[model samples]
Target: MKALILAGGKGTRLWPLSRELMPKQFVRFIDGESLFQKTVKRALLFSRPEELFVVTNRDYRFRVLDDLRELDVEVPTGNVLLEPVGRNTLPAIFWGMKTIQEMFGDSVVAVLPSDHLIDANEDYLTAFKRAERLAKNYLVAFGIKPTRPHTGYGYIKPGEAIEGGYRVEEFREKPDIETAKRYVEANYLWNSGMFALDTELFIDEVKRHAPEVYAAFENASTVGEAYVEVPDVSIDYGLMEKTEEAAVVPLNVYWNDLGSFDAIYDALEKDGNGNAIKVRGKNAYHLGIRSRDNLIMTERLTATVGVEDLIIIDTGDALLIARRGEGQRVREVYRQLKERNDERVLVHRTAYRPWGSYTVLEENDRYKIKRLTVLPGKKLSLQMHYHRSEHWVVVRGTARVAVGDREILLRPGESTFIPAGVRHRLENPGRIVLEVIETQIGEYLGEDDIVRFEDDFGREGDG
Candidate 1:
């Protein structure tokens, strides 16, 4: 069986931590493993590394690579499909299935989301087995039987038993609390965003029901053209709701989409005060006094006093405080920031790149200070900034610096200056990581001032 992972969603509801450049799937909230890494690990449990496929956007390609490397799991890079434009689940899944058909020919493929929190217990394996058996004749969807009234997730009603699962009777949107209470009482399952598909059957159904989506993938020679022509529709809206072959297998294992902070709170381990503290213990400490039932996540020493049932997310740049069950509305705040062109919406204090990452220590109108880390054997693009000049001081390891035409090897405490418009490159030539303190001074110190003459990651003109 081949595994297809959908990793393209920019988790906006998880703002302040999850950004446009770095989404929630790649953000490691706990366990030193991001949701994407966990998903990959789960995928590996059933399928080999070569048979695993990831569908993500063009922007997140490097982040995907970095995380996979961090886990020490190497997969064929070509299996990581890059969606030039996101048209939602329909296209992403369709593209992945089509590729699987070409490579392996009519295999049973399990579709999973890269950003969900799930318990990989015995029930999880049992559900997958049930779905696989059902997928031979039907497009099977794994559903979580709701334990409580949850207004956050869509509901699915199961009908007659078929194979190891049941036919999907009805699908419902996110309902109000009263409606959710009714759904919970009626034994409706939460629509876990995971599906098992027989590649050929799914393609045939897509062609019959979502012809527009099918035609785009079928006719295009490149993914770029396919995305532009494809309709921005979801698999549920395009095929599952319209097809007669829908089925849902009950996955009784614990599952949470982690779509909002409230869900995150529910999924995390809580303290004696019923507070969900994400940062506590060895690496960091979170002390709560008189705080009850609050969901809090922070890096530095964070303490809450007399706050109850509140979602308090504190990042270096932004802080969010809201009542419980109000976490879904974080998207509204993100919308406002995007409309106003707020830079905070796209990045945090630290930004990751293909080489490594850089943290902005300080910034002002005339100057900016950054701490850059270069992985061993990795190098920055051979480029120059037109509007800013840079001074780099090597703090650790060795650096092979190229400024204009001259090149030199610099050790710790050694510094170099590059005037504006001078082509320069920084490289870690040693076996250890290269750490450097960079100071920039100019009229315009924006990241876009870079003009890359050479880049290894094809990110010459990125922000």
Candidate 2:
């Protein structure tokens, strides 16, 4: 079966760590592997590298490529579908199914979300096999047997027993605590958001129940054109709930979407006092006294006293502290920040680019300091800032610099200055990664004050 990994969600509930440019799927949270990487590894269990596909936002193209490179997995580049805009799960799935049909013709495609944490053990393999069997006759959704009353996940009620699974009787929305308890009592399964779909069956179902969506993609010349007309509807809403072909295969495995801080807390290892502490960076550590049942994640030294059932997340640029049960509401903070056009809503102090990454060291109204790390053989765009002048001090490796007509090479401790409106480019010509300290002085230091003359990444506008 071919695999279609969805890596497009923003994961706003995990804000302060998960941002627009770097969503939770791309963030390394477990054992040096991003969730996306783990999902890729999981996909490989059922598919070869050549058969694997990914659907993600256009903004995440480089990140997806980087992750694949890290895994040493060579999926066909064209197989990576970049969505022009998010039109929810149905459109993304349809695009993947259509592509799979066009290439492999009526194959079984496993649809998996990249941000989920799943134990890809024997059970997982067996469950997918079961789902794939069901997919021949039904649009199969792998349903996790509910371990507890979880109000955060949608519930699926299974109907008459089929060959390897049961027909999906009803699809229920996320419920209140009392309703969730009732669901658990009734043996409702948590919607796993994973599917094993027969390309032809899925297409037929969409054509029958969601004709608008089917027409949008079938009639369009490009994915972008189709997206322009497709409504933002999920597969569950647009197809599964309305289709007679829906089937649910029970998947008994350790699965967690990590949708909220509370979920993260539950997934983490805890101390004797029930405190889950995760510290990033060498010098970062957490000390807690009377801090039972608290989830504390930090990048620097953090000490807590007399705290219980609290979620504390510190990512250098922002900190989130909330009561454990209120984790679902964290997205409200993200929405509020977005409403105010706060940069924190979009990125951390360190921002990633196609070329490399840069971390803000200091910034004020008139000046900004950044530590830029450019990978070997990589270069920034050939561009100039209209509002800011830049001073670059090389701290490591060698930098081939271009300041208008003057081309120069800078080694460790060497520096260069580019006046405002003067074109300049920084390239790492050495084998080692290049690190540079950049100081910008100007009246306006917004990232949008740039014009790209040449770019290797096909990027045209603001970074």
Candidate 3:
């Protein structure tokens, strides 16, 4: 069986932690392992590493590689399909299916979203086996038995009982409170967005229904062909709901989408007072006073008094304070920020790089200070900025710097300057992480001012 991981969602509801560049799947919000890593590990339960494929945006290609490298899983480099633009689940899944068919032929394929949390170990394995058996005639969708009257999730009503599953009666969208309560009492299951199907069967069904999307991929001559002809639609809307071959596999797994702060609180380890605290380093501390339920995460000390059912998140760059149950509307904040073209709506203070990472230390109107960490044997792209001049001071290890046309090695206490429009690069050749303090002086200090002439990670324009 081959597995396709959908890892391209922006996850706007999980703002402050999840951004456009760093979505929830890549964030280590739960435990030390990222949700993407956990999803990859889960995929390994039914398939080999060589059979796994990741569908993500072009911007996250390097981040995905870095995360996979952390787990030491070497997926086929070309198998990681990078979309030039996101067209939701329909295009992404169809593209992955086409690629899989071209490479592995018509086989059993499982589609899994990277951002969900599920605990059914043995049950899921058994369900996969059952779904594989049913895939000969139906498109199997794993449906979680609703534990509560959740109005946020879509409901799947079962029709007739089959050998391994049931016929999907209908697909219902997120309903009102009364509707949700009635459905839950009637034994409706929450749509898990998980499916297992025969590749050719799914493709044929998709072509029969959503011919526009199928035709876009079918006419492509190469794997590098852009899926621009496809519309922005979800698999649920484009194919699943319209197909008569849909089957619902009952899954009694402890599943949560964690799409909102309340869902995150529910999935976390709560204290005796019913509170969940997530700390980054040793400096994080939370004190709840007369509070029964809450989530508080901070970089330093946080004291809550007389506040209950709340979410208080304090990152160095931003702060979020919201009522617990009302946390689902946080996407509105993201939308407002985007309308204003705020960078905070997209990236974090600590930006990720292919080689390592860099954090914004301080910034002024004309100057910006940054603390950069370069991993050993890693190098930044050979690039230049037209609008900014940069000064780099090596604080630790050693930096192999390329300034203008000259190449020099700098150790501790040594510094170098690259004038504006001068091509330069930073490299760490030693066995230790190279720490450097970069000071930039420019009229425009945005990240898009760089023009990369060459990059090892295939990033020629942006780092």
Candidate topping TM-score:
2
lDDT of 3 by residue, 1-463 (tens): 9999999999999889889999999998888888999999999898898999999999899888998999999999878999988899989998888889889999889999999988857888988889989988999999998888998899999999999999999999999999999999999999999999788999999999999888887787753564667778999989989999999898877999989999999899999988899877586788778887898877777888888889988877899999988888999999999999999877888888889999999999999999999999999999999889999999999999998889999999999999999999999999999999999999989999989998988889753
Report the candidate with higher lDDT, 2 versus 3: 2
**Cα lDDT of model 2 by residue, 1-463, tens digit:** 9999999999899998899989999998766999999999999998999889999999899999999998999989789999999999999999999998898888999999999999988989998988888898999999999899998999999999998899999999999999999999999999999999999999999999999999999899988899999999999999999999899999889999999999999899999999988899899999987779999989999999998899899999899999999999999999999999998988888888877899999999999999999999999999999889999999999999999999999999999999998988999998999999999999999988988888989986654
Model number with the top lDDT: 2
Q: Model-by-model lDDT, in order? A: 0.90, 0.93, 0.90
Residue-wise C-alpha lDDT for candidate 1, range 50-162, written one tens digit per residue: 99999999989998988888888888978999998888998999999999999999899999999998989988988898888889899999889888998999999989988
In model 3, the clashing pairs are none
Error of 3 at 147 (Å): 1.2
**TM-score of each candidate structure, all chains considered together:** 0.97, 0.98, 0.97
In terms of lDDT, which candidate is stronger, 1 or 2?
Answer: 2
Q: What is the lDDT of residue 372 in candidate 3?
A: 98
> Which structure is stronger by TM-score: 2 or 3?
2
| Model 2: ten consecutive residues of lowest lDDT | 454-463
Q: Model 2: residues >4 Å from true position, as ranges?
A: 461-463
